[model samples]
Target: MTTIELDTTKLRADRLFQRKRLVGFAIPAVILAYLTYIFFAFDLPGLAGRANMDNAVTLVSDSWSHKVHVTRDNRSGEISYAVEGERKGRYPEGARPAWVTGDEVITIDLGGDHIVRYLPENRTEIEIPNFPLIEVRAEGRSLVTNLPDDLPGWISASNRRIGITTPEGRITLTGARTEVFNYFPGWELFWFTLDSPYHGQSLSKILFGERVDPARPNISGAMSDWWNNAMWRHKDVAWAIGETILMAFLGTMGAAIIALPLGFLAAKRFSPIMLLRAATRRLFDFVRGVDALIWTVVLARAFGPGPLTGALAILITDTGTFGKIFSEALENVDQKQIEGVSSTGAKPLQRYRFGVIPQLVPVLLAQILYFLESNTRSATIIGAITGGGIGLMLTQAIQTQKDWEEVAYYIVLIIAMVMFMDWLSGWLRGKLIGRKD
Candidate 1:
């Protein structure tokens, strides 16, 4: 009896050990097999070859830095100095940057050994630190360069155009235009354009010192110029941010308003009819089944792109979610409270108002405020699609491929907006429902 019993127990223990061993090996094996499949399925090996690290590095650098453009219109032979090659950032009349000097042969010092000179009669000279002195001439629609047959990797030359790239700056020569880009660390003309008298004034000066613009007060003038800055577009950006917040607010509040009644119909305690409850629950599932992004796409196609359309998309998608959540909360309410309200000879409406709603307020406010915060972030992506809000501006900046700094700015703003909404939601929740602490 002892021998047989000992063998059965040992056998059971062996089987359990074997099962555990199989699981341990199988988990790692499965993971390794999946990884191997992913390596080829996603073409991870080819990703390095496809990626342009140079462009990526340049884009990263551009996000924090600004570039000044010194351009020569070859046809008119009129040289112009501007920031980022924009008309709004063009230098004032009879004025130019201190780095650029010369009346006849315009010499541009690109802050390193890199130097460029605009000579008379469509001729240009470039001086790089290590490279040989190069000269080129533009004749009508073609560029004739003194560049050797075997040029450096940094230099790109053709019959019509030539481009020289260096760490300090870049130079491009074409039949129609000759331009030099000089990189600088900070965002230039961020507060005020070249046209503004307060462009170079310090904040302290604007706030405490003498007036910069004689026609207007220092504070007012500085504010006006900064708000109206064409390069930064602070006014437009503020409006876009407002649209995004409004979209989220309208959508979230609207969804809550629509979901409340439906929630009541779905709740077992409130609506006793099985058929009505099932239908309402199904409606909730149907609306929430599709993602907000999918809803956004559908609404955009039907109603056309607008902030209101984005709000509607959010409203539709969240209605289902809110309905499910509210229904669940309603079902979990205290029966004693409802009975107490009923004992006072309260009507059905009065019972709900006094008993059910009081119990649900905490849950309702908590869910509503959370969704409101979440919807704010969602609104950004929705705004991009609906052609409204900061998302549209961010997309425009990214698509341009020229102003990475502006893209960075918009990204920072988006993050800040999300953080602010999070803080506001938490603060409101604490104030309304009492803090957990």
Candidate 2:
């Protein structure tokens, strides 16, 4: 009998090991099959062919660099020098870049032996090292160019327009105008536009040196110019950032206020009515499951697009989430404390106020502060759809396609804003919760 019992136990152990081995192999096989299905379903091979790597390279490079435009009107024979080809950044009359010379001919030396000469009669001359000179003459409604048929990929020419792209700069010739773009590192005119007297002055000079603008004090004038900088719109950006913070604050706090009662209704321990609890739970699920983006679109139509619309969208979505979280927290509260308060002959409301709320405070505060930080980032994206905050500025900059340096600036500001919010949330949490080491 002993031998038979030992044999049965050994056989059972062997079968368990065999089952484990089969599960391990089967799990990996199922995962591999799912991955194979996803690879074909996503059509990754076709996507590779559609990707344009050269455009991606250009976009990445542009985000870090700026370009100055030297454009000439072919019909009027008037030439203008502007940073990023913006009127706000146009160089004052009688002033020009050092690299450009000759008033009559207007010689532009794009470093590395690549030069462009704007001549009379709307004729343009391009000289590239180790290559034949390319000449283009813009006549009324047509462009005549001497570009060879075997020109490199960088040069595109036709009877109506001619485009030359080089490492140093780009030149485009057409029947209406001839433009030259000179690339340079760093954001130009970030603090002040070309018209400002403080444009070229150093910070130390502005702080300690003699007044540059005779009409105003040096430091005060510099501050005014920077704050009102037309090219960078510093004032506008500051206001937009404030709007985003406001949206997050109003939305998160309002949702907390509205969800607390709903949470009590949903929690079984607090509310004994099962039908009411189920209805409240379904309401929470309905709002929370709809996604913030969809809510933003629906609210935008009702509220007509502003920071208020964004705040309302966040409020509605977070209300459902807070209801669910608060209900869970309520369901897990210690009943011993409640019973002790009840033993003191305290009323129902008093017992809840003293016993239940104290236990819920830590969880409520922690969740509220966390969502405050998270909703700040969400507000930025929601603001884009609602036409309100820094996100709208970022969207406009990206849509312009030429102001990539500004896009980079907005991205940096957004990152800094998020980091600051995270720090603020953690500090508040520590202060309110009696820091947990």
TM per prediction: 0.95, 0.95
Q: In candidate 1, residue 113 scores what lDDT?
A: 76
In candidate 1, stretches whose alpha carbon ends up further than 4 angstroms from where it belongs are: 1-3
* Cα lDDT of model 2 by residue, 165-239, tens digit: 999999999999999999999889999999999999999999999989999999899999999999999999999
**Against the unseen true structure, what C-alpha lDDT does each candidate score?**
0.93, 0.93
- Expressed as tens digits, the lDDT of each residue in 46-131 for candidate 1 is 99999999879978999999998999999999999999998988999899999999999999999777899999999999998878
Please state every model's RMSD to the true fold in angstroms.
1.9, 1.9
- Model 2 residue runs over 4 Å out of place are 1-7
